[model samples]
Target chain A: MSIPITESITVIDTTLRDGLQIEDRVVPTALKVEIARALVDAGFRHLEIGSFVNPKKVPQMADTAELYRELGSLEDEGVTLYSLVFNAKGAQRAVDAGALQVKLVISASEGHSRSNSDSSIAQAGDRLLAAIQVLKANNVAFEVGTAVSFICPIDGPTPPQNLVSILEPLVAEGAAGVGVADTIGNANPRMVRTGTKAVQQAFPDMPITVHLHDTYNFGIANVVTTLEMGITRFDATLGGLGGCPFAPGAAGNIGSDDLIHLLHREGYSTGIDTEKLAGIRPTLTRAIGHPLSSKLSTIPAVPEPAPIGRASR
Target chain B: MSIPITESITVIDTTLRDGLQIEDRVVPTALKVEIARALVDAGFRHLEIGSFVNPKKVPQMADTAELYRELGSLEDEGVTLYSLVFNAKGAQRAVDAGALQVKLVISASEGHSRSNSDSSIAQAGDRLLAAIQVLKANNVAFEVGTAVSFICPIDGPTPPQNLVSILEPLVAEGAAGVGVADTIGNANPRMVRTGTKAVQQAFPDMPITVHLHDTYNFGIANVVTTLEMGITRFDATLGGLGGCPFAPGAAGNIGSDDLIHLLHREGYSTGIDTEKLAGIRPTLTRAIGHPLSSKLSTIPAVPEPAPIGRASR
Candidate 1:
């Protein structure tokens, strides 16, 4: 029997934000804008440019507001730019910067919540309520996402109830969508399937996106598993850049180039031109100042001049 | 809503044979025996030690006979050791070395067959027919395997019909089992699912094993897809050791260490102790004179003191 494949999936390029958020060298605003424009030109409509965290804490993303202002022209092109916001203050910063969409992120595990947000999951949720209200007041569209939704570095595996409870307020307040992330790049496919399914069952109508890191080389496998569960959205970074400062052992996010290759090979229409995507990788490589870890970054693209062996048949 | 996982799977460690075949340095015979011994102690019942090919062409595998002699005692312990044979002479060499079992491999694609064996598929099959007769005369159990069963390096994809056509003679000869190899590690899950399903349908009673390379980081994903197709057997190399000399762009076999980690995380029993398996990696690394490419080889094992997250729930 064949896997029931979804015809198409939406890819949100998080290169400028998650891909560069943890890099040692802070990229200039102009370079970031250029990268975003390149991504948009390569057929990505949804892009996460930066997070609205404290500039003092995350210096790399200190220019989020500036980036929003710089990309104001992209908004007219039907581009939906997203920024991460944790509390009312961040939401206000996003609103003040003319942000149209924001993703409210909280850790589902107490351990991650303490380290990443300096609060427990409940405390974080309380803080996010204020952010939701601020986002509502500003009339900015918002979604809720959980960090370490499957496994936690300190607290260990997060129960599905933990995720559901963490998401209660956001889901109840009519968040536009939901996202679950493998914050540490450690969750297996089965965990993703179970956790995502739990969310799918609870909010059947909500658009769900999974953000994964290729820390264990299980990113694509997890993506395949989620696809089996009917998920049609994923978040990736260009040239596989990204890691969380708080998440130990986390590697780069799944490479947009590699993921698109898998999606296309599996007969899923991602509507992104891989050749054009590959063209932008050198800029990312220079921005990160290191060799990118995604498979496509290392290997030259094989020309499909003709189907080899049985593909011809 | 959860993924329907298989209860168990069989892992065949092919490090000694496939992993070391293409290395520039030829490891010592004693080291080969020690590695095989460590693998068996770690609960790997199946191990492919060496191939009975031209020793001059494959100098790294020149110690095949002596290594087999050294490991003869392992047969009494319920360990099944496999060596590859192509022609009647190679089959005779295996029998003379007291090989209880052998695997006859040929490329499913004409492109690979011409390059790897310096013969056409028809010519290779004619030679394999002689080898099969020799194996029967020697009372040695053997199985048939096809390299590049899905995608070929020179040729593109091998149609399912090509694989079936290649396996027809061996199946008619009553081969013990069948193995389909992604010789170049370029196959995506769709190709794997389609090609493997074709083989499975043709030989419903045949036990099939998949040999994959992690060239594109699709090894584990292909494993997951095949598992979903009810494929229970896989071949892997330790520390992700092994690549193809004939197949360009081939990286390493899906690291046995990494594959086992995925299988265990997905709740499948492989009967192999990962800790013990990991212990043997340093030795292989020393022998190979380089670091292994597997994810587990680079990272510390995640302590599963308790199943975290939704798995616990």
Candidate 2:
């Protein structure tokens, strides 16, 4: 039997945040603002522009606070700009910037937590509680997401219970939603379904987001599986820009451009301007000083749409 | 509900044929024999080594007849070597070469048929009738396949009825199986599911194989869709080496190496050796004089498998 395509989907553009976080160049705050304007114009209502991490450690996002101040028009348009807050200090920066919403990040696996956050999973999560409190006190809505939620390079595969336990504090702290990040992008469809299903079952009332990478080319397959399971929100980067340290030279997030191409071709409404979306890749490539990893990055012109056989008739 | 991973699947590697046909250099017959030996050693029971088209038209496969004779030992091991025969002349070549099996190819759309085969779809079908008699007379087990079976670069999307009507003659000739090709690699999951299911429903008893390219990064997603629909036979290439003439600079077939990785990690059995499969990329790259398009071709080593959460526990 043929699976019916969902009529519409919500795509969270994380290009300026995760896409450029690990890149060598520090994109000017002006360029970041320009990209955000283009994104909003391209029909992306949700965007992750930067992380509120320590500037010394992540200079790429040092301008995130500045970006928040510069995005007056987008915020006025009721667009959601997500700033990743890793700790209480990061949360304080978002509050200082008057951020409307924040995504608190932690690792689910013990090894990733220790290496990524300089603490164990529990310690890393506990640190988020302080961040959660600051966000709540400041009246800023926040969502908590766990990295390495499915498979960790250091701690092996994460148990569903471990993920649930890790999210319990944030959920208790009144996280508006929970997000699961397949940070290294090695997850298969089965892992996605099982792991995301576990998280959804654990927090029955919370909204969930699925973050994916294309390291093993399983990203889109997992996306299809996620859609088949009725989960809507997805995080994608422009031109597939993020790189996984674990999967060196592998592709980053499934490209938002590529993902939109798939969605539209599959008869799903994403409210994205395909023409405007295609225009962003050139600007992104120039800003990054390199070609992008997404398939669309290499394709100069989009081919005419080919209707499905029976659907056309 | 989550789709159950099939216990096993049949992967038909079209590497030597489709993967190399369009390469700048014609891989020598001796080298092809060596690679074919490696593929067989790597646990591929089904392989498409070459096409029996005219030397004047596709000189890259001028050695197809020789490859058949050279693969005597592999055939003794019961590995099926499929040679593509486009018309009566090509079919005669297969018979002369004592080909154990042949894939008779016809395009489903008139535009692709005119461009690729220099004949209309109906005219191409007429040519295959003579080819079919030759194969049946020679006791050659054969399968029929249609290129541009899903979306035609020239014909837009081919109707499913177009495909069925084209295949009817071959099915009447007692063909062993049928294959549908996304020669342009532009299919989305809906297209893959709908087009494939239509073919399956039309021919209730015939075994079906899906052929795909990765022009728009939809290859693996389409693979997942086909698997979800319970169709197990897949055609892939080593290191994603095939090129789509319709969509140049896009990816070729979904990489056999990548496909095997997905299948194995998803807990599906392919009996294909990942280690041996990984080793093919280097040799394939050297032979082709360039890097391959497959994700696995970029990675230096295979990452250790991360177990699925609940499944592991």
Candidate 3:
């Protein structure tokens, strides 16, 4: 039987970059490269390997250049390596490190902007536009990521119209597309559908990627709603790694294995073997020295059925 | 602007009974009564207050009779109090405790039956039939609750045909309705819609209640699908209080506040005041000796609009 939905969904694995940011334990540069290789081997088309932020604030991402260099030498032609950049300097650093795509993040909510970046919304927008210009001059592809686009911890619900107001100028400034991040993990499926609908209405042809956190546990549900809305791209972390150090009580991003399982079960092909994805859980657990918060990690592999009754008979 | 969907969906609060069963802490009888009264005050039409089970095994529900008597004496018109029973003896206890409706639970999955009830599926069916006979003889309004009706913890997914097989005999036994319980908290919205549709097809006129747990965090999502299928009656817990003790690692049931919020937002009138429901969270938290697991608990009442300054000012 031909399935209605095929394995056309793009998996953008952000375990090394975003996952390392929120994790309490600092993953070594070598482990980050190993994770990238594993993610590529697991058929991820996109891998966010690291961020180019200051080393003092985010120690886990200090070895970004070394990690990027290792991944760049890997023979995998299917993987498109990317990194996160908060400013023009970071964007320049990412381009120097040989990253094909550099993601620039700006907070849509003013409260989060002040808390996360110590900048106003307009200032952050200006920074993002400048960074996009720099990346363009360097011949690097870039996307403007709007963090806390759905609901902010301090600001509550973000009006969709305000989000559009921020996006229009960035798209004009050579941003390849816009990525909406649920930084506090509060967006429900309904909110996601409504928010995405609003953005899609404003930028009809703009490619949108949704970055979700599982804090309120609506991550996968929101992904399903987005899928129904014809959004085939999303960001997920291995073993559900990563949460914002600044965003208090924010849990990890949606688990990649859990996301794969949900999509596969719903008849949407994600081109991921869930069992193989789950195999990396132990490595993540040992690296973090604590149990990961993924449901799929704990479940024993479903045993195959034995041949019927010959021995008993 | 009038909304097309029905507003006054019936809220059946199942916290005291189903919720208590999943709790590790033994809630006192007074606290159970307090939760039950709070649920009624929150506009719940039906409340499953407690269960008549062996005190030794489920010590949390040791005072079912006292809890029922206290709630019965309130004489709250329009409120229907229910008690869950597992066998004929428990059914008699429920009826004697002045329960307006007595609910009996049996598993549709054979594996769940063996693990949960320590009996084969056939033996459990016989026990359920005996309990039904007892309820019928007393003319007590009764419902047969099929626990793990959607998916079994040990058996994985329960086939729709297996659910039909279980519901058929119960309908024949004059069951007023059958409830589908996501006992292990493993159901998705599609599974809920499919399972509910199958059972409804098998018994056209029978009332159905969808009891969900938030383990995988699809509780409210499944409820939305249930609503799309025109299922108005559902089981919820105040402050998302309960889970199954037998099913390890299951989270609390869908919070009544969150469910009411979703229904009201979708143009369905639940006759529940969102503010009042949120206010009850603290009381439940204090009684449970821990904070409740609801998203809406801390949401400040959506403040009324501030007055605009005069043009002269």
Candidate 4:
């Protein structure tokens, strides 16, 4: 909202993890690797493939460790695979998989924290602190992510102070990056700008990533605000694949295809190949067993994206 | 992209005209009247009720004259009603219906002009010129609008110069405003900013309204860019309820309900009541005989929109 965005951004494709976690059908680990590779071919260097939570609770992501190990070679190609770890057990799984990086997520609001995981923010932090031990023990670099960083479905509008409070403890534990999520996709641009500013102010040294859901179609606006504030890391699902099972009307992260198209059209290079995006979209539709929600996914046959006014970095 | 948006915006709801034009089943006039009234109650000062196109060509809008007459009293409340007119015959219909204002539209690109109206842009411009004589003869104020203002479905990206060339003649005829449309919704934010800026610079004394479709989900991002660049007039449908029959994969305009929510959330008021928006939405869903596409419509029950940091102009 303040500055014009000209810098190249790191778009984290979270299709395998956040996208599939809410689905009743569990995507097999091989198919997950295929989608992951398709994304890497499309030029995504950072990816969030799965979370190491309870397999029983999120059966779709039960193969997190396996998927992480399978895609481990991507690190050689300069691609960083990410997983969401909530506790020491999840952290142990990360270590077992030889993970290079992991995103440790805790809900910012008590209501979401309780619903997403049966614990309050304090209790989740203690679990995360323990998880850090396991991650540090194995030398895995971890980024801390907060769910409902902008607005909580259960509680209400989250004050920016609450986000800072929750992340203060985690960031102090040598977290490499701080992640803010609009878990319900209900945040206004102003709220996103203010909250993101607060997080940047609190931990100016930490790289900030904004994870967005398009439940209310405000995801792109939040993307605009976050980019304007000079923060560039964004987490999105390919073809908008994920939704929250706990939040009644949550939508998937904003579509990576759509976001990349916007970025490329605005002269920012994501290094992701837009033509290759079409190849991976059908796999998602066929595997997810439902029609996709991304705008590009619904089109009959869009010409491979036209990069208009591409800005030279 | 250059200015901070701090002004009140006029959101013109085109649900009755463009929203219903492509539907096979023509909506009864009574229902159209009911929807118009509901929009006015929601604080929409400008409403596009219908277009005076040939009944056989676009049967859905055959009732344009009737709807205009039925809602004539709203003009007393400072509500300016708009209808799309293509030729002198359409302009005659508007004058006969006691119209105070009308938006005369022509395609900006030759390919779209051929497909949409079976004529080239120059030929269609001549027809609009004829329409202007009839409008001026009756002293009815008019605004000139161009379809495919940013990109044509058949042609590639529209150069900004093309918009100015097509609009120059019409603007010279004492037109009150200029309307630029991304008729196919393929416009990215940069295209929108460049095109809109071209129009603003060419017609420095005139009001500019942008009509957008969401075929690519860039509508909201374009909305952000256009608003940031200080264009205050927008056109949208009630539930993302419009599409083009000639355009193979066109989606509806960005939803009025969704746009109002975004505007309100950003501290800008559209003079539209968000609470009343929900009540009128079901009427549209029922009339359209299909599920609506607005993000707000898809959600089971969105808490009435909250205007965070509402700005007072």
Highest-DockQ candidate: 1
Q: What is residue A82's positional error in candidate 3, in angstroms?
A: 1.4
Q: Tens digits of per-residue lDDT for model 1 on A1-313?
A: 1344559889999998899888899999998998999989999989999999889989999999999999977989988999999999999999999998899999988778888878778888988999999999889999999999998878777788778877877889879999999988898888888899888888888999999998888999999999888899999998788888897788889998889988887778887988889999888778778888888898877654144423443
Give the local distance difference test score of model 2: 0.83
The prediction achieving the highest TM-score against the true structure is 1
TM-score of chain A of each: 0.95, 0.94, 0.92, 0.94
**TM (B chain), model 1:** 0.96
Q: Which stretches of candidate 2 lie over 4 Å from their true place?
A: A1-6, A244-250, A306-313, B1-6, B246-250, B306-313
Backbone clash tally (model 4): 1
- What TM-score against the true fold does each predicted structure earn? 0.96, 0.95, 0.83, 0.92
lDDT of predicted model 4? 0.85
Sort the predicted structures by DockQ, highest score first: 1, 2, 4, 3
Per-candidate Cα RMSD to the true structure, in Å, reads 2.3, 2.6, 4.9, 4.2
User: Which pairs clash in the backbone of model 3?
Assistant: A22-A243, B7-B269, B22-B243
Give the Å shift of residue A119 in candidate 3: 4.0
Best by lDDT: 1
Give the 10-residue window scoring lowest on summed lDDT in candidate 4 chain B. Answer: B304-313
Report the lDDT tens digits of candidate 3 across residue range B27-106.
Answer: 88877777777767767778887788898888878888998778896545877877888788888887788776778788
Q: Candidate 4, residues A44-81: lDDT per residue as tens digits?
A: 99888888888887899889888867898999989988
* Candidate with better lDDT, 1 vs 4: 1
